[model samples]
Target: MNPGVHAGTRGTPLTPTGLSRPSVRSAGLLLGLALLAAATALSLSVGTRHIPLDQVWSALVAPSGTESDGIVRELRLPRTLIGIAVGAALGLGGAVMQTLTRNPLADPGLLGVNAGASAAVVTAIGVLGITSFTGYLWFALAGAALAATAVHALGGARSATPVRLALAGTAVNAALFGYVNGLQLGNLNTLDEMRHWSVGTLARRDPALLLTVAPLLVAGALLALALARPLGALALGEDQARALGTDLRRTRVLAVLALTLLCGGATAVCGPIGFVGLMIPHAARAFCGPDPRWLFPFCALYAPVLLLVSDVIGRIVVPPSEIEVGTVTAFLGGLLFVHLVRRRKVARL
Candidate 1:
């Protein structure tokens, strides 16, 4: 049986079997929100020096000139906020990619978006002598936009087939990675700065840094949310969507623009964190079926859960010297991906 085919031909919304119950969806959303809150609290409290919940509350409510105040206000607070934003961006980006390509395994990292941004940053550092991340941010966004345009062009945007897009992304990703590696190898200065930024982490981020990329991330997120219905309409196939008056060209352009902003902004702030996007969207599908509208909300809530939990785990797993959040998420997400594959739960729309 063709997994993509179904009995309905009216372009009506389709939910995965046994998962369309409204009560179930409501419960799932509530549970996801609760878990997100818990994770946010955990992120604020648990670290190298674990702060008690009461102290955490006090630090949040009113700083009292204590050591906990400094740690809470200065360090963990910004890191937690950034983690939430980055995680949400990755999750939404992943959802968008999977929906756009109708591919179960699509992600920004795998699609060369992250590599393109990273390469641009490296180039800025090496050739342009851009010393600060603020300078790197503009270059990263441009690189991501260019890479996305290239991918669509190579993939035959007029047709916009899944296999062609994936192949083009793979080829572009490899080429960009080669350039990044070449730059790193040739310049010791580039290597030193690039190595640290390349390992995705939420540490040492200032509240001011969050302000830098917030507008882009917010814009991308709002665009994604607004396009939820059109994305769902896409599941009915291109011909059906066109018959229903969906503009395929406009949709593709908008989706690409939204993805560039989200992926580019996140990478600019926290490096190229992988798997969050790939893992969360599939999980969202399992919870709320394949409706992009439903899936995105869950993705927004649960992705931060995964990211914050992974960061907390990273803090304690190795004690004094903490492992990066990216490493922890990669380890966990890889295991989840393997498990999902084993169970045959991952499928294209």
Candidate 2:
């Protein structure tokens, strides 16, 4: 065993390098906060118009009806705020999902949350003639909850293992997404409306929309944080966690609920932005080890950094046209996922 690495649950060397110490974990968390701040600043400053940092700050603090102020207050601020919220939700959700499944590669989507949200959104636009974000938000949440609940039932609620849950979720995801695709293909109007949204960009999100979903996301975040200890115990294996008095069924149920709230709200707002939930946990693990106590907070803070930075990149990559943030993350995350698989042995939880 390397001196710098510490054994985690099941004697796995989960901590990389010198991050095993509490002080180091705290420092890493602070660093994540700094990165988030920088990402927020960049999201505000770097856009098609390229407002200076000072001007961005000025616009935020004191709006003077200038073009910059209008752009900052009306446009970038909402986008940035939504980005932060969505990013945090995805990141925290991913971490919890991965921990619950004991699979480092697992993401929130593995539970059918994204697919469920997408199917509902497609239905909203195609069948219900609902085009507004606010109108479809509740439908998205209901769909996600139903899908996850069905997954749990299929997985045998009481006897559900990680593998069983994953398989059930995959089945549900396939079915729902297939339905979504067919509906979209059959209706050009629905397809046109969904084209931009399905690609997952944070552009033109209303602040009021964020406010509407804020409570749900915040509740989900709190629930995820609360599950850290139980998840950590579960990572040690079911028998061990049970021996330690952890109620596996209750924990799993709550975890699913938390994920539904987190991923559901995020998908409702941003239309299934990929890779933040998939990638941020892995990055946070390298710095905070496998302990959900540390990893969750790190993911919560730094995930927004990845999301906001990607949004900024999207804005500048194609002049005025700009790539969608989801497109950028998918491209980057695909490469990173490949690298993670090929470069090192996948960590076992």
Candidate 3:
């Protein structure tokens, strides 16, 4: 057996032309980028009014102040940009999370991060009467950090297994979301404000909100990328990872911090879009063979493709009315979840 080659579930070396070969992985990355570009174009062009690609390009380059220009520039462009940023954050966060936990089912939401953010945002709206995205952003970050910390403590940080952490996260997720529901049910204003947000649409978000959250997303992305090598080492097993000079404590700490920033910022701006994190990493692993270096970038590119395509579909699926992107993803992710549960080979990390 070659020390350089990682083995898949059946002990097959994961270096075939279709798998972990550097050339093939690089080509896959390019293909992902191409797909993302097409998704972005479709997102801009396939909205309620169905603007043409020429007009979309013109709106970007030279705006004539037409309704099409308003739709393209004011609405779709910001939505597309937010989708890209949030999708990349969720994708990279999910890859890091699954690697850190050594769990195939790990995602940002699995650890209660999204629930914490939602609960905090609801608190801000209902209790504090804070209506600004910036305010929600701060509360969301705080809640995510607190929830992750609680999960770490409850899971027995020094001796936590993947199962223990997952159980702890599940407990915390249920509790926080229950609290969120209670607040929404008690306050009509909160419920009204959270109606669309809870469903997770990319519509009606202010462009300024993107500017506010950009730094957090970039920082989280950089941190997640930097953890790739250490996380890959950790994936080999804790004893082996320690032998290879991986700092388990520091790695876990940074990974959690990165998850908080990425998940919190995304939930803040877009209101907790699901399944992008869960599905994209698995899809990337199919092509990249679980190497975090390749897997992270591939997830980043392809997650937005899934998200934007879902948003476009949500727009056109019904007549003038549209479904939320979250609803679309939830339906799709539910199918994928069923398939994963039935297929043992794909479900193991």
Candidate 4:
């Protein structure tokens, strides 16, 4: 197996660690789920108003039309749920993109997904006068799909290599981002909306929009999970995959479709929150190894932990005002990436 791409955390468990591979993976998975649950509680309880655990629980079990119930049921509940959904989507999307591209640094944004979404949102606000989250959602998905399709076409379709695909995506990302900048500069209203959305906050979210995108994330997640075996086979190299009777074309197409749906839906809802996808897979690999079957589940559980922790931290770090989840994750994930590079765990792709 290619250690860099296919096998992370490669080693036999030592007695000193008090765990075998299966045990370690199981522990990690359990811990991740527990953390997610705790974070969800914290998210519901520790917002600007600071509803107590008891109050949050009361609001959940029995709604009395009180202020606490409104905060718990109407406001924080949706935000927390959206955070979980978006976090899971981004984490899985990043893992899928990196494995398919064989690039440890590959993130959902690397494929122009975020840029395309941004361009669409900016265009909608500026040209179409659409100023609602619901309006942005559909536009973002369409743009992301179009951008991914363009990248695949430019990368040579069935013959595209991961390097070529990445390069094409980078080019498309730059062009779309440039176009987004032009749109923002030309319109004051667009600039204001873009500035807020670009920072990526789960605040002021439309529950309906979140509900609308949930199916896309679910579909994409199922597709990504289904491709685990194919991706594992592909990690062995194209010739080896072909020799093993894997269909490379089918795999790539489905993989791209998965990324587009996951990343697009996430961007549409959360406005391009960064780093959840970039950091979760590598972290999961460090604990459980590089098998996608294990990695995907770990990511699905652990990513919401990271996100909710960040969201909670963002709420508390500044008191009256809060930091954006995107900013917090970007800083933390960038630091991790740098540490990995300095440790030589990540090589040039």
Q: For each candidate, what TM-score against the reference? A: 0.91, 0.93, 0.90, 0.93
Question: What total of clashing residue pairs does each candidate reach?
Answer: 0, 0, 0, 0
lDDT of 2: 0.89
The digit string of per-residue lDDT tens for model 3 on 1-349 reads 6665677656545563335465567778889989999999999999779899999999999999999999998889999999999888888888888998998778898778888888888999999999777677788888888888888778888776667779999999999999999999999999988776777878878888889889989999999999999999999998999999999888887888898888888888888888888878877876777989889889888888888888899999896999999999888877876676667464566
Q: What is the lDDT of residue 276 in candidate 2?
A: 85
Error of 2 at 167 (Å): 0.7
Candidate 1, 88-195: lDDT as tens digits? 998998998898878878897656789889889999999999877677778888888889888888888877676887899999999999999999999999999887
Error of 2 at 165 (Å): 0.3
Clashes of 3: 0
Predicted candidate 2 versus true structure: per-residue lDDT over 1-349, tens digit per residue: 6765777655544445534366567788889888889999999999899999999989988778899999988899999999999999999999999999998778988999988888888899999999888887898898888888999899989999999999999999999999999999999999998786688879977788899999999999999999999999999999999899999999999999999999999988888898888888877776678999989999999889988989999999899888899999888777877777666675456
Clashing pairs in 3: none
RMSD of 1: 4.5
Query: Which residue ranges in model 3 land beyond 4 Å of their true spot?
Result: 1-20, 336-349
Query: Model 2, 215: alpha-carbon shift in Å?
Result: 0.3
